[model samples]
Target: MRQLVRAAHIGPSLAVVALATLLAIADGLPAQRVLLVALAVLAGQLSVGWSNDLLDEARDRAVGRSDKPLASDAVARRTVLVACVLAVVAVVALSFACGWAAGAVHLAAVASAWGYNLGVKSTVWSWAPYAFSFGGLVVFVSLADSPPQWPPWWLPVVGALLGVAAHLLNVLPDLDDDERTGVRGLPHRLGARLIPRVAAAVLLAATLLLALGAGIGHPASLVGLAVVVVLTAAVLLGRGRVPFVAAVLIALTDVVLLLAAT
Candidate 1:
């Protein structure tokens, strides 16, 4: 069970779910609706994670990536496959439970991520999935509202920027392994040395959008921008998990400010 859980990429899965939950709350969703959004996002994320592991199983094994449960044979591939299928079903039902608009947006996001897993991750267009998925997440939350309205344009822009940054950062740790297995995404083409700088720049751009889009003159917006700058610096300068942790913090801060602005 633990191995199966590991195979699901639990950390990233939970982070995506948490972002959905926060967006729901920021949108002033009722508790029940918020829970529905969280469940739908969770199911979608689980499916994405599981499928990614399943698809990459051979590559992982080739690279001797023991950290991957499928690569290490810690869990049966069939088990993970079955779980992924279940998650897909649950995501579909739960997302529609929120409403047609919300469901469609959520499903589209899931599909984009699945596209990445299937083969897009190896192409220059790898970043497209993350941009669409993350931007669609913002739209999904808004459409989940009773009236099903769209969010302010800046919100989805910020989300897309963050998504791009996420893609770059995510690939940094696996660049070598991916290269060994013939994977060459946009980040891979950018090379390791430049990816971090690009990621930091992307993150900073999101922060700027949040500040200016939210309300440039607002004292809180200025404070939030300052904090985000500090966090972005940490992402560039920090070692090990520090950069990732700081990136997450920067995201949370931006979301909070965005919510407040809205």
Candidate 2:
């Protein structure tokens, strides 16, 4: 059960939910709408996680990753199926509670994630999943109130860069395993030596944009930029595990930005 839970990557999903909440709050979403948006975002993430486990079960087992719930048989296939169904239902319910526009964003996110897990993850354009997933999230937060607007126009651009970094970093540790399993996506194509550099470059671009976004006036935006700069420097200096730490700092910075914006 522990392995299964970890395989679900629930913690990361929660982080994504928290990030969505920050974006929503920053955009001035009402309390009720914020709650609904959080639920929708979490549900969408759960759907993605569950679907990934299901689709990767064969590969995971082949790699001897018996720690995974599905791989270890700690949880029944039917259980995962039920979970996926419930997650989708939750998304629908929250979407309805939030509004059609919000619901559309959730559905789009779910669709994109599902697409990636099913087959897109093996393609050269695997980064599309991260881009679409984060993009949909930004759109959802942007549309939280009425017409949306909190994040500057450049937010999504920075977000795309962040998405690329996420993809590269995420695949770093799994490169060998992924290659052995024939999951030679974009990250694999980049090769090991270049992947970290790519990640650094993406993080740098995101920080620059974030700084530029804040320079016009919103000082709070600098918080995230600062975190990114420090974290990126750490990673480039051979502190490989620093990305996870940087992720936490980034999340905190986002929260601070939201509070300042509001």
Candidate 3:
């Protein structure tokens, strides 16, 4: 069970689910609806994470990725495959329970992620899925409201920029392993040294967008922007895992400020 959980990429899956929960709270969704949204997001993320491991089994094994349960032979491939199938079914049902509009938007985000895991991760368009998925997430939540309206245009753009920053940061550590396995995604092509700089810049843009969207005149907006600038500076200058950690802090700051402003 533990191995299976790990193979599902529990950390990232839980992180996404947590974000969904926060968004649900921020959107003032009812208790039942918030539960449904959490479940749907959880299922969708599990499917994405599991399918990613399954698809990359060969590449992960080739690169000696013992951290990956499937690649490390800690769990049976068939087991994870079945789990992924179940998650897909659950996601579909739960998403629609939220409403047609929200369901469609959420499913699109999940499909974009699946697209990434399928093959786009190896292409220059690797960043595209992240952009679509994260932006779609915000829209999905907004559509869940009774009126089913779109979020402010800038919110989606902020989400997209954050998504891109996430992708660049995520790919940084695996550049060598990915290159060895012939996975030459955009970040890999950019090489390691440049990725942190790009990620910092992307994150900075996202921060600026959020601040502007929240109204620069707001004290919270100014404070949030200043904090993000400091964090992004750390992302650019910090070494080892420091940059990744700082980026996560920046993301959290952005989300909190977004909720407060909205």
Candidate 4:
């Protein structure tokens, strides 16, 4: 059980579930539908987590990253593989239970990540998967409404841009190891000095779009603006872990703004 828990990367999965559930609630979805969407999100995030670990098992072992359950041999590779398949199946089934349109969007989101796991993560277009996946997620959740709603156009824009920033920040700490393992991606091409700058710029762009969508005088817009300025400053000027942590906090701020907008 503990091994399975580790294989599932429950911490991140829980975060996804929490965020999706909150979004559903913010959309005023019925409790039943909220539960369904949350379940689907949980399954999709699980698939992403397990597939990520499984696909990178060889590299994790090579890098001696024993903190990973697969690398430590605390979880069997076949077991993790089976869990991944099951989670994918669950995501498809539960997403469709919401609605056909919602299902398709959610599936595409998960598939984008799958594409990344397959090979896209090594390419210059690595940000594609993250953008599509995250943007499609907002679309999927909004589509779960009874009459089917579309979020503000800028919502998906913010989502996609933040997704790209996330990709950059995520790769920062592992840049050296990823290079050694032959994984370049977009962040690698930019190098360390420019990655944070790019992330800060993207985050600022996302917040600006949100401000325009939400109205400059709106409280949510004001808060997002403030967060954007502080975080962008930290990313551009701070060294060590400050930039990465700031980027994560900025993403959280976006999530809060999203919920407020809904």
lDDT of each: 0.89, 0.73, 0.87, 0.87
Query: Can you write out model 4's per-residue Cα lDDT over 1-262, one digit (the tens) per residue?
Result: 6877887778867976787899889999999999999999999989998998898989988888877899889988899988889998999999999899999999999999889988899999999999998888888889998978988888887878878988887788789888888999999999987888888888888878888887889987997899789888998889987877777888778778877877
lDDT of 3 by residue, 4-121 (tens): 9998889878987887788778888888888998999999999999999999999998888999999998999999999999999999999998899999999999999999998999
- How many clashing pairs in candidate 4? 0
lDDT of 1 by residue, 1-262 (tens): 9999999899989988988888889889999999999999999999999999999999999989999999998999899999999999999999999999899999999999999999999999999999999999999999998988799999988888888988998888899999999999999999876776677778778878888887788888899889988987887888867777777677667767766765
- Candidate 3: misplaced stretches above 4 Å? 236-244
RMSD of 3: 1.5
Poorest lDDT segment (10 consecutive residues) of candidate 1: 253-262
lDDT of 1 at 111: 99
Off by over 4 Å in 4: none
Off by over 4 Å in 1: 230-252
| Model 2: lDDT of residue 161 | 66
C-alpha RMSD for every candidate: 2.1, 3.0, 1.5, 1.5
Candidate 4, residue 150: the lDDT equals 88
Which scores higher on TM-score, 2 or 4? 4
TM-score for all models, in order of appearance: 0.92, 0.85, 0.95, 0.95
Output the better candidate (1/4) by lDDT: 1
Candidate 3: residue 227 lDDT (0-100): 93
